[model samples]
Target chain A: TQLLEQSPQFLSIQEGENLTVYCNSSSVFSSLQWYRQEPGEGPVLLVTVVTGGEVKKLKRLTFQFGDARKDSSLHITAAQPGDTGLYLCAGVATGNQFYFGTGTSLTVIP
Target chain B: DARVTQTPRHKVTEMGQEVTMRCQPILGHNTVFWYRQTMMQGLELLAYFRNRAPLDDSGMPKDRFSAEMPDATLATLKIQPSEPRDSAVYFCASGLVRGVGTDTQYFGPGTRLTVL
Candidate 1:
Protein backbone atom coordinates (compact mmCIF):
# COMPACT_ATOMS: atom_id res chain seq x y z
CA THR A 1 0.00 0.00 0.00
CA GLN A 2 1.12 3.53 -0.78
CA LEU A 3 1.49 5.69 2.27
CA LEU A 4 2.07 9.41 2.68
CA GLU A 5 3.51 10.70 5.91
CA GLN A 6 3.13 14.31 6.97
CA SER A 7 5.52 15.99 9.38
CA PRO A 8 4.84 18.45 12.15
CA GLN A 9 1.47 16.88 12.94
CA PHE A 10 0.43 20.01 14.83
CA LEU A 11 1.60 23.58 14.51
CA SER A 12 0.74 26.66 16.48
CA ILE A 13 1.95 29.97 15.22
CA GLN A 14 1.12 33.60 15.58
CA GLU A 15 -0.61 35.57 12.87
CA GLY A 16 1.62 36.65 9.98
CA GLU A 17 3.98 33.77 10.60
CA ASN A 18 5.17 31.51 7.85
CA LEU A 19 5.12 27.72 8.10
CA THR A 20 5.82 24.73 5.91
CA VAL A 21 4.32 21.25 6.00
CA TYR A 22 5.91 18.24 4.37
CA CYS A 23 4.44 15.11 2.79
CA ASN A 24 6.70 12.26 1.88
CA SER A 25 6.15 8.90 0.26
CA SER A 26 8.31 6.06 -1.02
CA SER A 27 6.19 5.50 -4.10
CA VAL A 28 5.88 7.72 -7.13
CA PHE A 29 2.58 9.41 -7.69
CA SER A 30 0.83 10.51 -10.84
CA SER A 31 -0.56 13.57 -9.12
CA LEU A 32 -0.62 15.25 -5.75
CA GLN A 33 -3.29 17.45 -4.17
CA TRP A 34 -3.45 19.69 -1.12
CA TYR A 35 -6.60 20.36 0.82
CA ARG A 36 -7.60 22.52 3.78
CA GLN A 37 -10.46 21.56 6.04
CA GLU A 38 -12.16 23.67 8.64
CA PRO A 39 -13.88 22.14 11.61
CA GLY A 40 -17.41 20.90 10.93
CA GLU A 41 -16.85 21.07 7.15
CA GLY A 42 -15.40 18.88 4.48
CA PRO A 43 -12.00 19.43 3.01
CA VAL A 44 -11.65 21.90 0.15
CA LEU A 45 -9.08 21.49 -2.56
CA LEU A 46 -6.34 24.09 -2.47
CA VAL A 47 -4.08 22.97 -5.25
CA THR A 48 -3.06 20.04 -7.45
CA VAL A 49 0.48 19.48 -8.71
CA VAL A 50 1.01 16.92 -11.44
CA THR A 51 4.61 17.34 -12.50
CA GLY A 52 7.88 16.83 -10.73
CA GLY A 53 9.61 20.00 -9.50
CA GLU A 54 6.41 21.93 -10.21
CA VAL A 55 5.46 24.87 -8.06
CA LYS A 56 2.00 26.43 -7.87
CA LYS A 57 1.15 29.52 -5.91
CA LEU A 58 -2.32 30.62 -4.80
CA LYS A 59 -2.14 33.95 -3.03
CA ARG A 60 -0.19 33.21 0.15
CA LEU A 61 -0.13 29.46 -0.26
CA THR A 62 2.65 27.77 -2.18
CA PHE A 63 2.72 24.09 -3.13
CA GLN A 64 5.67 22.17 -4.48
CA PHE A 65 5.99 18.69 -5.89
CA GLY A 66 9.29 16.89 -5.49
CA ASP A 67 11.64 16.36 -8.38
CA ALA A 68 11.24 12.60 -8.01
CA ARG A 69 7.42 12.76 -7.57
CA LYS A 70 7.82 11.09 -4.19
CA ASP A 71 7.23 14.11 -1.99
CA SER A 72 5.37 17.41 -1.71
CA SER A 73 5.36 20.51 0.42
CA LEU A 74 2.94 23.28 1.32
CA HIS A 75 4.23 26.64 2.52
CA ILE A 76 1.95 29.31 3.83
CA THR A 77 3.17 32.89 3.93
CA ALA A 78 1.80 35.45 6.33
CA ALA A 79 -0.80 33.09 7.61
CA GLN A 80 -3.87 34.63 9.21
CA PRO A 81 -6.52 33.42 11.61
CA GLY A 82 -8.51 32.16 8.68
CA ASP A 83 -5.72 29.74 7.86
CA THR A 84 -6.20 27.77 11.03
CA GLY A 85 -7.40 24.35 10.01
CA LEU A 86 -6.33 20.82 9.15
CA TYR A 87 -4.22 20.53 6.02
CA LEU A 88 -4.08 17.25 4.12
CA CYS A 89 -1.97 16.03 1.22
CA ALA A 90 -3.19 13.23 -1.02
CA GLY A 91 -1.43 11.36 -3.79
CA VAL A 92 -3.04 9.63 -6.76
CA ALA A 93 -1.36 6.50 -7.97
CA THR A 94 -1.19 5.05 -11.47
CA GLY A 95 -4.52 3.29 -10.89
CA ASN A 96 -6.26 6.55 -9.83
CA GLN A 97 -6.54 5.45 -6.22
CA PHE A 98 -5.86 8.21 -3.71
CA TYR A 99 -3.72 7.84 -0.60
CA PHE A 100 -3.90 10.57 2.00
CA GLY A 101 -1.23 11.81 4.36
CA THR A 102 -1.49 11.88 8.11
CA GLY A 103 -2.36 15.63 8.04
CA THR A 104 -1.11 18.70 9.87
CA SER A 105 -3.35 20.68 12.15
CA LEU A 106 -2.54 24.40 12.16
CA THR A 107 -3.57 26.92 14.76
CA VAL A 108 -2.95 30.48 13.71
CA ILE A 109 -3.34 32.81 16.61
CA PRO A 110 -4.37 36.44 16.27
CA ASP B 1 -22.03 25.38 -7.28
CA ALA B 2 -22.39 21.62 -7.50
CA ARG B 3 -21.71 19.73 -4.26
CA VAL B 4 -22.08 16.27 -2.73
CA THR B 5 -24.82 15.81 -0.16
CA GLN B 6 -24.93 13.39 2.78
CA THR B 7 -27.82 12.57 5.06
CA PRO B 8 -28.06 12.58 8.84
CA ARG B 9 -25.25 14.98 9.64
CA HIS B 10 -24.91 13.30 13.02
CA LYS B 11 -25.92 9.94 14.45
CA VAL B 12 -25.57 8.29 17.84
CA THR B 13 -26.17 4.58 18.24
CA GLU B 14 -25.26 1.78 20.60
CA MET B 15 -22.86 -1.03 19.85
CA GLY B 16 -24.11 -4.01 17.80
CA GLN B 17 -26.58 -1.74 16.04
CA GLU B 18 -26.81 -1.27 12.31
CA VAL B 19 -25.57 2.05 10.97
CA THR B 20 -26.31 3.42 7.55
CA MET B 21 -25.02 6.54 5.88
CA ARG B 22 -26.14 7.87 2.52
CA CYS B 23 -24.66 10.18 -0.03
CA GLN B 24 -25.82 11.96 -3.19
CA PRO B 25 -23.07 12.81 -5.55
CA ILE B 26 -23.11 16.02 -7.54
CA LEU B 27 -25.05 16.01 -10.75
CA GLY B 28 -23.06 14.74 -13.72
CA HIS B 29 -20.33 13.27 -11.54
CA ASN B 30 -19.52 9.68 -12.43
CA THR B 31 -17.39 8.78 -9.42
CA VAL B 32 -18.16 8.61 -5.72
CA PHE B 33 -16.03 7.71 -2.70
CA TRP B 34 -16.43 6.95 0.97
CA TYR B 35 -13.78 7.87 3.57
CA ARG B 36 -13.54 7.52 7.31
CA GLN B 37 -11.70 9.94 9.59
CA THR B 38 -10.84 9.67 13.21
CA MET B 39 -8.48 11.36 15.66
CA MET B 40 -6.18 8.37 15.55
CA GLN B 41 -6.39 7.17 11.95
CA GLY B 42 -6.74 10.54 10.27
CA LEU B 43 -8.37 9.61 6.95
CA GLU B 44 -8.87 6.24 5.31
CA LEU B 45 -10.64 5.33 2.09
CA LEU B 46 -13.37 2.77 2.58
CA ALA B 47 -14.84 2.42 -0.89
CA TYR B 48 -15.60 4.13 -4.19
CA PHE B 49 -17.86 3.72 -7.18
CA ARG B 50 -17.66 4.70 -10.82
CA ASN B 51 -20.62 5.03 -13.18
CA ARG B 52 -22.80 3.58 -10.43
CA ALA B 53 -20.66 0.48 -10.34
CA PRO B 54 -18.38 -0.41 -7.46
CA LEU B 55 -14.79 -0.07 -8.55
CA ASP B 56 -12.87 -0.71 -5.33
CA ASP B 57 -13.71 -1.69 -1.80
CA SER B 58 -10.52 -3.24 -0.57
CA GLY B 59 -10.19 -0.73 2.20
CA MET B 60 -13.53 -1.69 3.68
CA PRO B 61 -14.02 -4.58 6.07
CA LYS B 62 -15.64 -7.38 4.12
CA ASP B 63 -17.60 -8.83 6.97
CA ARG B 64 -19.27 -5.88 8.67
CA PHE B 65 -18.91 -3.06 6.18
CA SER B 66 -20.84 -2.87 2.94
CA ALA B 67 -20.93 -0.10 0.35
CA GLU B 68 -23.36 0.17 -2.52
CA MET B 69 -24.40 2.58 -5.20
CA PRO B 70 -28.02 1.71 -5.79
CA ASP B 71 -28.27 4.40 -8.47
CA ALA B 72 -26.14 6.97 -10.14
CA THR B 73 -27.19 9.60 -7.67
CA LEU B 74 -27.13 7.74 -4.39
CA ALA B 75 -24.44 5.78 -2.53
CA THR B 76 -24.75 4.09 0.80
CA LEU B 77 -22.39 2.69 3.45
CA LYS B 78 -23.76 0.25 5.91
CA ILE B 79 -22.15 -1.29 8.98
CA GLN B 80 -23.76 -4.20 10.77
CA PRO B 81 -23.16 -4.81 14.43
CA SER B 82 -21.13 -1.66 14.61
CA GLU B 83 -18.59 -1.41 17.35
CA PRO B 84 -17.15 1.50 19.29
CA ARG B 85 -14.30 1.52 16.84
CA ASP B 86 -16.79 2.55 14.18
CA SER B 87 -17.35 5.94 15.75
CA ALA B 88 -15.86 8.43 13.40
CA VAL B 89 -16.69 10.99 10.76
CA TYR B 90 -17.69 9.30 7.51
CA PHE B 91 -17.13 11.49 4.46
CA CYS B 92 -18.53 11.11 0.94
CA ALA B 93 -16.78 12.61 -2.03
CA SER B 94 -17.58 12.80 -5.75
CA GLY B 95 -15.54 13.39 -8.81
CA LEU B 96 -16.12 14.03 -12.50
CA VAL B 97 -13.58 11.63 -13.92
CA ARG B 98 -11.87 8.36 -12.95
CA GLY B 99 -8.18 8.76 -13.64
CA VAL B 100 -5.36 9.95 -11.43
CA GLY B 101 -4.13 12.81 -13.58
CA THR B 102 -7.16 15.10 -13.60
CA ASP B 103 -9.88 13.81 -11.33
CA THR B 104 -10.78 16.41 -8.72
CA GLN B 105 -12.94 15.17 -5.87
CA TYR B 106 -15.52 17.37 -4.22
CA PHE B 107 -16.32 16.37 -0.66
CA GLY B 108 -19.59 16.56 1.23
CA PRO B 109 -20.15 17.70 4.80
CA GLY B 110 -19.23 14.50 6.63
CA THR B 111 -21.64 12.41 8.65
CA ARG B 112 -20.44 12.19 12.23
CA LEU B 113 -21.33 8.85 13.79
CA THR B 114 -20.89 7.97 17.44
CA VAL B 115 -21.18 4.34 18.45
CA LEU B 116 -21.49 4.10 22.15
Candidate 2:
Protein backbone atom coordinates (compact mmCIF):
# COMPACT_ATOMS: atom_id res chain seq x y z
CA THR A 1 0.00 0.00 0.00
CA GLN A 2 1.71 3.12 -1.17
CA LEU A 3 1.01 6.40 0.61
CA LEU A 4 1.52 10.04 -0.33
CA GLU A 5 1.86 12.70 2.33
CA GLN A 6 1.20 16.41 1.81
CA SER A 7 2.55 19.26 3.88
CA PRO A 8 0.66 22.13 5.47
CA GLN A 9 -2.73 20.45 5.65
CA PHE A 10 -4.38 23.86 5.98
CA LEU A 11 -3.05 27.15 4.61
CA SER A 12 -4.49 30.62 4.98
CA ILE A 13 -2.69 33.56 3.41
CA GLN A 14 -3.51 37.00 2.18
CA GLU A 15 -4.07 37.69 -1.51
CA GLY A 16 -0.94 38.18 -3.65
CA GLU A 17 1.06 35.96 -1.32
CA ASN A 18 3.08 33.10 -2.71
CA LEU A 19 2.75 29.60 -1.34
CA THR A 20 4.15 26.18 -2.10
CA VAL A 21 2.73 22.73 -1.28
CA TYR A 22 4.81 19.60 -1.10
CA CYS A 23 3.95 15.94 -1.68
CA ASN A 24 6.29 13.18 -0.75
CA SER A 25 6.32 9.38 -0.95
CA SER A 26 8.81 6.66 -0.26
CA SER A 27 7.83 4.62 -3.28
CA VAL A 28 8.83 5.66 -6.76
CA PHE A 29 5.98 6.40 -9.12
CA SER A 30 5.76 6.36 -12.89
CA SER A 31 4.01 9.71 -12.96
CA LEU A 32 2.65 12.40 -10.70
CA GLN A 33 -0.24 14.81 -11.17
CA TRP A 34 -1.48 17.89 -9.36
CA TYR A 35 -5.12 18.75 -9.00
CA ARG A 36 -7.15 21.59 -7.56
CA GLN A 37 -10.64 20.96 -6.25
CA GLU A 38 -13.06 23.68 -5.31
CA PRO A 39 -16.06 23.38 -3.03
CA GLY A 40 -18.97 21.32 -4.33
CA GLU A 41 -16.91 20.12 -7.28
CA GLY A 42 -14.69 17.20 -8.15
CA PRO A 43 -10.98 17.67 -8.58
CA VAL A 44 -9.74 19.22 -11.80
CA LEU A 45 -6.43 18.25 -13.29
CA LEU A 46 -3.72 20.91 -13.02
CA VAL A 47 -0.69 19.25 -14.56
CA THR A 48 1.00 15.88 -14.97
CA VAL A 49 4.70 15.41 -14.50
CA VAL A 50 6.08 12.20 -15.97
CA THR A 51 9.85 12.35 -16.05
CA GLY A 52 12.21 12.97 -13.22
CA GLY A 53 13.19 16.60 -12.71
CA GLU A 54 10.42 17.66 -15.04
CA VAL A 55 8.77 21.02 -14.62
CA LYS A 56 5.48 22.21 -16.01
CA LYS A 57 3.96 25.64 -15.72
CA LEU A 58 0.30 26.56 -15.95
CA LYS A 59 0.04 30.31 -15.83
CA ARG A 60 0.71 31.33 -12.23
CA LEU A 61 1.15 27.74 -11.05
CA THR A 62 4.45 25.91 -11.44
CA PHE A 63 4.87 22.18 -10.77
CA GLN A 64 8.06 20.20 -10.29
CA PHE A 65 8.75 16.49 -10.01
CA GLY A 66 11.53 15.14 -7.86
CA ASP A 67 14.63 13.80 -9.50
CA ALA A 68 13.96 10.38 -7.99
CA ARG A 69 10.22 10.47 -8.76
CA LYS A 70 9.48 10.11 -5.05
CA ASP A 71 8.22 13.62 -4.47
CA SER A 72 6.60 16.62 -6.19
CA SER A 73 5.81 20.25 -5.50
CA LEU A 74 3.35 22.92 -6.57
CA HIS A 75 4.23 26.62 -6.38
CA ILE A 76 1.78 29.41 -6.94
CA THR A 77 3.16 32.80 -7.90
CA ALA A 78 1.34 35.99 -7.00
CA ALA A 79 -1.61 33.99 -5.73
CA GLN A 80 -5.03 35.51 -5.89
CA PRO A 81 -8.38 34.80 -4.26
CA GLY A 82 -9.39 32.60 -7.19
CA ASP A 83 -6.37 30.38 -6.61
CA THR A 84 -7.65 29.23 -3.23
CA GLY A 85 -8.81 25.62 -3.13
CA LEU A 86 -7.85 22.12 -2.12
CA TYR A 87 -4.53 21.06 -3.65
CA LEU A 88 -3.95 17.34 -4.12
CA CYS A 89 -1.07 15.36 -5.55
CA ALA A 90 -1.73 11.94 -7.03
CA GLY A 91 1.03 9.49 -7.85
CA VAL A 92 0.50 6.66 -10.27
CA ALA A 93 2.20 3.47 -9.30
CA THR A 94 2.48 0.21 -11.13
CA GLY A 95 -0.72 -1.62 -12.07
CA ASN A 96 -2.40 1.69 -12.76
CA GLN A 97 -3.15 2.36 -9.12
CA PHE A 98 -3.21 5.98 -8.00
CA TYR A 99 -2.30 7.09 -4.48
CA PHE A 100 -3.63 10.49 -3.49
CA GLY A 101 -2.07 12.84 -0.99
CA THR A 102 -3.74 13.84 2.28
CA GLY A 103 -4.68 17.17 0.64
CA THR A 104 -3.91 20.82 1.35
CA SER A 105 -6.78 23.20 1.85
CA LEU A 106 -5.75 26.73 0.85
CA THR A 107 -7.57 29.94 1.58
CA VAL A 108 -6.44 33.22 0.04
CA ILE A 109 -7.80 36.14 1.99
CA PRO A 110 -8.51 39.24 -0.06
CA ASP B 1 -16.49 19.28 -23.33
CA ALA B 2 -17.31 15.70 -22.42
CA ARG B 3 -17.72 15.02 -18.73
CA VAL B 4 -18.71 12.12 -16.50
CA THR B 5 -22.17 12.17 -14.95
CA GLN B 6 -23.49 10.75 -11.68
CA THR B 7 -27.00 10.37 -10.40
CA PRO B 8 -28.57 11.22 -7.05
CA ARG B 9 -26.35 14.22 -6.24
CA HIS B 10 -27.42 13.91 -2.60
CA LYS B 11 -28.86 11.02 -0.61
CA VAL B 12 -29.71 10.66 3.05
CA THR B 13 -30.61 7.18 4.21
CA GLU B 14 -30.95 5.37 7.48
CA MET B 15 -28.54 2.75 8.63
CA GLY B 16 -29.10 -0.85 7.48
CA GLN B 17 -30.68 0.40 4.27
CA GLU B 18 -29.39 -0.45 0.83
CA VAL B 19 -27.73 2.41 -0.99
CA THR B 20 -27.04 2.46 -4.67
CA MET B 21 -25.03 5.09 -6.57
CA ARG B 22 -24.75 5.29 -10.32
CA CYS B 23 -22.31 6.85 -12.78
CA GLN B 24 -22.21 7.47 -16.51
CA PRO B 25 -18.79 7.64 -17.99
CA ILE B 26 -17.83 9.98 -20.75
CA LEU B 27 -18.12 8.79 -24.30
CA GLY B 28 -15.17 6.87 -25.77
CA HIS B 29 -13.65 6.26 -22.36
CA ASN B 30 -12.86 2.68 -21.41
CA THR B 31 -11.59 3.19 -17.90
CA VAL B 32 -13.91 3.95 -15.00
CA PHE B 33 -13.18 4.47 -11.35
CA TRP B 34 -15.12 4.89 -8.12
CA TYR B 35 -13.77 6.94 -5.25
CA ARG B 36 -14.88 7.91 -1.76
CA GLN B 37 -13.89 11.23 -0.20
CA THR B 38 -13.88 12.23 3.46
CA MET B 39 -12.02 14.66 5.62
CA MET B 40 -10.07 11.93 7.37
CA GLN B 41 -9.24 9.67 4.44
CA GLY B 42 -9.19 12.31 1.72
CA LEU B 43 -9.86 10.59 -1.59
CA GLU B 44 -9.73 6.80 -1.76
CA LEU B 45 -10.33 4.68 -4.80
CA LEU B 46 -12.89 2.02 -4.07
CA ALA B 47 -12.90 0.29 -7.43
CA TYR B 48 -12.06 0.68 -11.08
CA PHE B 49 -12.97 -0.93 -14.39
CA ARG B 50 -11.25 -1.21 -17.72
CA ASN B 51 -13.22 -1.99 -20.82
CA ARG B 52 -16.25 -2.71 -18.66
CA ALA B 53 -14.31 -5.28 -16.71
CA PRO B 54 -13.51 -5.06 -13.03
CA LEU B 55 -9.77 -4.46 -12.70
CA ASP B 56 -9.18 -3.77 -9.02
CA ASP B 57 -11.45 -3.59 -5.99
CA SER B 58 -9.11 -4.32 -3.13
CA GLY B 59 -9.66 -0.87 -1.69
CA MET B 60 -13.35 -1.53 -1.16
CA PRO B 61 -14.81 -3.46 1.74
CA LYS B 62 -15.71 -6.80 0.22
CA ASP B 63 -18.19 -7.73 2.92
CA ARG B 64 -20.79 -5.07 2.18
CA PHE B 65 -19.61 -3.00 -0.77
CA SER B 66 -20.06 -4.04 -4.38
CA ALA B 67 -19.14 -2.32 -7.63
CA GLU B 68 -20.07 -3.30 -11.14
CA MET B 69 -19.93 -1.87 -14.61
CA PRO B 70 -23.02 -3.20 -16.31
CA ASP B 71 -22.20 -1.54 -19.61
CA ALA B 72 -19.79 0.82 -21.25
CA THR B 73 -21.75 3.85 -20.20
CA LEU B 74 -22.78 2.95 -16.68
CA ALA B 75 -21.07 1.94 -13.47
CA THR B 76 -22.68 1.32 -10.14
CA LEU B 77 -21.58 1.08 -6.53
CA LYS B 78 -23.84 -0.41 -3.92
CA ILE B 79 -23.63 -0.77 -0.20
CA GLN B 80 -25.82 -3.16 1.76
CA PRO B 81 -26.78 -2.50 5.37
CA SER B 82 -25.16 0.89 5.28
CA GLU B 83 -23.64 2.35 8.42
CA PRO B 84 -23.23 5.87 9.72
CA ARG B 85 -19.52 5.79 9.07
CA ASP B 86 -20.21 5.27 5.39
CA SER B 87 -21.16 8.90 4.96
CA ALA B 88 -18.97 10.44 2.30
CA VAL B 89 -18.92 11.87 -1.21
CA TYR B 90 -18.65 9.19 -3.86
CA PHE B 91 -17.06 10.20 -7.15
CA CYS B 92 -16.89 8.51 -10.53
CA ALA B 93 -14.11 9.16 -13.02
CA SER B 94 -13.50 8.10 -16.60
CA GLY B 95 -10.33 8.06 -18.62
CA LEU B 96 -8.63 6.58 -21.64
CA VAL B 97 -5.46 5.00 -20.40
CA ARG B 98 -3.17 4.29 -23.31
CA GLY B 99 0.22 3.75 -21.79
CA VAL B 100 1.59 3.09 -18.34
CA GLY B 101 0.49 6.41 -16.80
CA THR B 102 -0.66 8.80 -19.48
CA ASP B 103 -4.34 8.84 -18.66
CA THR B 104 -6.03 11.97 -17.37
CA GLN B 105 -9.26 11.04 -15.60
CA TYR B 106 -12.25 13.32 -15.69
CA PHE B 107 -14.34 13.25 -12.54
CA GLY B 108 -18.03 13.58 -11.96
CA PRO B 109 -19.77 15.94 -9.59
CA GLY B 110 -20.06 13.09 -7.03
CA THR B 111 -22.93 11.86 -4.93
CA ARG B 112 -23.03 13.05 -1.35
CA LEU B 113 -24.38 10.23 0.81
CA THR B 114 -25.20 10.63 4.47
CA VAL B 115 -26.12 7.53 6.41
CA LEU B 116 -27.89 8.04 9.70
Indicate the residue-level lDDT of A33 in model 1.
Answer: 96
TM-score of chain A of each: 0.97, 0.97
* Weakest lDDT window of 10 consecutive positions for candidate 2 chain B: B96-105
Per-candidate chain B TM:
0.95, 0.97
Per-chain TM-score of candidate 2, chain B: 0.97
Give the DockQ of candidate 1: 0.83
For candidate 2, lDDT tens digit of each residue in A32-68?
Answer: 9999999989999999999999999999999999999
| TM-scores of all predicted structures | 0.97, 0.98
Worst 10 residues of 1 chain B by lDDT: B96-105
Tens-digit lDDT string for candidate 1 (A1-110):
43999989999999999999999999899999999999999999999999999999999999999999999999999999999999999998865788999999999999
lDDT of 1 by residue, B1-116 (tens): 78899998999999999999999999999989999999899989999788898889999999999999988889999999899999999999999884435688999999999999
Checking candidate 1 for backbone clashes, the offending pairs are none
